[model samples]
Target: MNANMRAAAPTEVLRYTAFSADPDGGNPAGVVLDASALDDAARLAVAAEVGYSETAFLTPAPQGTEGAPEGRAFTTRYFSPLAEVAFCGHATIATAVALGERIGPGELLFLTPAGPIPVTVVGGDGESGPRATLSSVEPHSEPVEDKDLTEALAALGWARGDLDPEIPPRIAFGGNDHLVLAVTSRERLGALDYDFERLKELMLRLGLTTLQLVWRESAGVFHVRDPFPVGGVREDPATGAAAAAFGGYARELGIVPEESRFTLHQGEDMGRPGELTVDLRAGDPRVHVSGTAARIG
Candidate 1:
């Protein structure tokens, strides 16, 4: 065996679905409670073996890490079938729920590559499983370059007229960067046929993790879809990172009030429906994404 392979220790990986209480719904993610002995190659291998879009690996954080409670802090990393990403929302939620089941629901801290993420876990009573709320790091948005936007649209086979002029196009950042494009109608949003290689090239050049395609249903509700070619997944059922970034984008552009709560419906087109709740506080620039998760038997 190779040195890297030999260095990997057999660790227990928990499988869970985030953003939905039903196991068949939501996005499935693999969570490793103790990956301290696993190397990058090992982690990648595990993620590929699990066949999920993303998997979270957790190692105990150093004692007294800032903002972390004495026994509830962990250093976390995310890996997809193809590569390691700076952050992943669904995987984070799945990991938190898995931890909650073992340690009892409470406040927990995760030191991720993007930044420190504070998560609160509650419930696990009766039939409903544990729910987790993760507060993202400060979010921001920047205008999408004209050339990049054009290229992106071309990859998706979409015309400029199909875009929602009200929302505009922007590159938003929560934990990872995402290209936000609001479609004019739900029909246009549902017809998501994109050139995989072309979009992947554009995403890599722009340092984007996914394309957050959205269609507003009402003042506080929207249907969202994420094409994650960069992560080697065709689509993400429920994307927490993109939801957080979208909240920031909306607040930054005044599409929503300073303090507002919104619901994001995702994965419906893929048949695995899930819901994500986004909360924007008046004074805090950070976005909070909350959802429920259940173990997949």
Candidate 2:
């Protein structure tokens, strides 16, 4: 029975959520451990097989099959039901936790299209599943021009006055580019009426991946909503990558204190609430977004 035991389950596919514990609480993702066995079409079929928005396909780990405790990591690729993305934060989180369950949780390194990301699996507890936090690659942000800002505002049907003076407009990047627009009023953030097609077109034209609409509730806390027209979704519930990017943007532009740790509350308006915590170090460029996930049945 021990010799007959296979390392991987027959299904080879696992489902988990990012940023929350409840099954219905967070972003769902599909994970495939040994996608090397499947061709592109087969892998894609497997992704569509799971029917999640995005699924992660992993390449065979490395020359050294470095076992658990310090768990094995591999090159990871993300694909939506439609197409591939440079990266997906939620899927990365889900995949990390899945691997942790098998390898017994420690440091797992993922070589992503964007770069190498390090994930630490903090092992499971009595009733709780394992938790993993991935530190993003060198994060950075740039100023969004006035002209482009106007167009973005137009696409979202949001006026300039709606923006918060403290947190100005900026384009941020962790693995993907997101235009961070801060709204002054919570009402404006809650009233998320936007031109879907128009925003999508604008995003494509500008090479933007998502629009990070944020309403700062306080110095250490914020309410965030992401408009992801490019991903073919109206919004992302909890965006770990975007939160990491925002941490960089805020720190660089003096929007927040030099070394500040903050919490972002998102998807409340959509009713699938999630929380993200971003920790910023004084000299380090890597942004860390931490959250726990649960299996979504």
- TM-score for each of the candidates: 0.96, 0.90
**Off by more than 4 A, model 2:** 1-11, 44-51, 64-71, 124-128
Number of colliding residue pairs in model 1: 0
Q: List candidate 1 segments past 4 Å from native.
A: 1-9
Candidate 2 versus the native: TM-score? 0.90
Q: Please provide, for model 2 over 251-290, each residue's C-alpha lDDT reduced to its tens digit, 9 standing for 90 to 100.
A: 8888888788899998788778877878887887888887
Top of the candidates by TM-score: 1
Clashing residue pairs, backbone N/CA/C < 3 A, model 1: none
lDDT at residue 238 of model 2 (Cα atoms): 80
Report the poorest 10 consecutive residues by lDDT, candidate 2: 62-71
Q: After best superposition, candidate 1 residue 168: deviation in angstroms?
A: 0.5
On residues 18-42, what C-alpha lDDT tens digit does candidate 1 reach at each position? 9999999999999999998889999
lDDT of 2: 0.82
